[model samples]
Target: MSTDRFKDLPIHSYQSIRGDIQTGDLLLCSGSYPVSKIIKKVSKSRFSHVSLIFQWVDRLMILESVESYGVRIVPLSHYFSDYRNSGKPYKGNLYLARHSAVKDLVPNKLNAMLRRGADLTGQPYDIEEIVKILASVVIDDLTSIRNDKYICSEFVQECYKKAGLSFQDDGRGFIYPEHISKDPSVKPLYELIP
Candidate 1:
């Protein structure tokens, strides 16, 4: 929670503290587009997407499942300067976050979690899960998420489970960016906004 180091939202630059970010960190987005607005409205939450971070050699990359690309890895800088190759910053508030349990994980466990992320690359995005998530929220039903496909948040939840870190859903429902954000173990680090 000592995100003060980044000087809060509208961060001067992601590079200033880029070196401080580590694998197992997270990126939460409160997007501005129509689909993002729909997600926020349906879930009654500010954040519409969540991605897991991985430190790959000299670069920090993100593992996220998007409607167009499914599960893929992209340099962290992509969001700051070239989202979707648009030559513009991402269209929303981006918060850096971390899970306290991740720090305690052994290297093998951490690697396993990250390995799962890597293995999931190119997996198809689950549009059905998105509908199910929104429906679960509306009607208050507990639905089990399928393993063959993923929504952004579901992918993150699955990866963390490989490291033996549970968000403690207790089979209550689908995982959402808001649910991860509100978890006691997930600490806010900084916010970078375009």
Candidate 2:
């Protein structure tokens, strides 16, 4: 919770922070995109996006469902660079969160979660579901439209469920980045300022 650890580091330090990211860690982010702005407004939360981290070979990669690229695995470098180019004054304003119960997870369960995320690679981003989510926010309905595709937070929730850790179960698709961030089981690791 201390801002002291969230220093304004150069872009190159993103790689150093990548070393600290573990598989199944959640990368909660605040972005400058239009949809991001709307999500923040609706959720009333600073974070508008979330990605699950996984180790691939020698480096770390993030599995996320982005509107532009859909569900995909990208190197941590790409994730950081995208934020750096966002034109936001506070680029890379991200917080890393790890489930407090992760330490108690067996290796198989962790691997299952990673595999679940990996299985969704190349899936399309659910734009319709996003609209429904936004509409629900406006109406205060909180209903979700289940679909084959995924948005960011729902994908993360599914991965955690596969890993045997279930946090919020407002049915399957009714989740947002704020919901995950607010969960008491998820502990903040570090925040990258600017």
Candidate 3:
């Protein structure tokens, strides 16, 4: 499909579809912060961040590797209400995405994926990797993504890899949200309002 299909998506109300979000779903964000703008400009991607959505028993939570906090879990509802302790909705467009391979994950693989994500919790965000990504290569090699620290895409990419779904980017380098968005096996599920 053309990239056009990924643009002009219809926004969906968060309240109406919160119940429909499944574990392994993705939250793709186009943030407006200064750093977010830098990422988008450098990567040439509309989305600057990506977070994995997991259903932990009775609640939905987001697993993301963010600057300052590293990899952490947050209540999914925080985005629609107060995000970043800023008392505002997220500062950019939010899109829900899913990998076609998620449904095929057997119990063992699913558990393994969750476990891997959990293990990475509290790790630091890869600030060095960000510098490396933006400094040397204009077309970033994303080479250091597999290190202990992670970027949001690295965490999500690593988790999905555990679930038996491997994105198209070779394991050689880090995966970016733009790369994931362009993958054939991933599809947009919704355009979340805030």
- Top candidate by lDDT: 1
**Clash statistics: count for each candidate:** 0, 0, 1
Worst lDDT 10-window in candidate 1: 1-10
How do all models score by TM-score?
Answer: 0.90, 0.83, 0.91
- List runs of model 2 lying over 4 Å from the truth: 1-12, 82-92, 169-173
The pairs that clash in candidate 1 are none
In order of TM-score, best first, we have 3, 1, 2
Residue lDDT tens for model 2, 83-171: 43563333426778788887788889999998998889888898887787778766676577666799899889888998788667445
Candidate closer to the true structure by lDDT (higher is better), 1 or 3: 1
Looking at candidate 2, what is the lDDT of residue 172?
40
Look at candidate 3 and tell me the lDDT of residue 24. 85
Judge candidate 1 at residue 34 and give its lDDT.
86
* Per-residue lDDT of candidate 3, residues 88-161 (tens digit): 88888889988888877788988888889999999999998788778745654446645788988888888888
The whole-model C-alpha lDDT of candidate 1 against the native structure comes to: 0.84
How accurate locally is residue 185 in candidate 1, as Cα lDDT from 0 to 100?
87
Q: Supply the TM-score for candidate 2.
A: 0.83
lDDT of 1 by residue, 1-194 (tens): 22233244445468888888889999988899888998888867778999999898898899999998999999989999999999999998888888998888899999999999999999999998787766776567658656689989989988999999877552665777777887878888878653
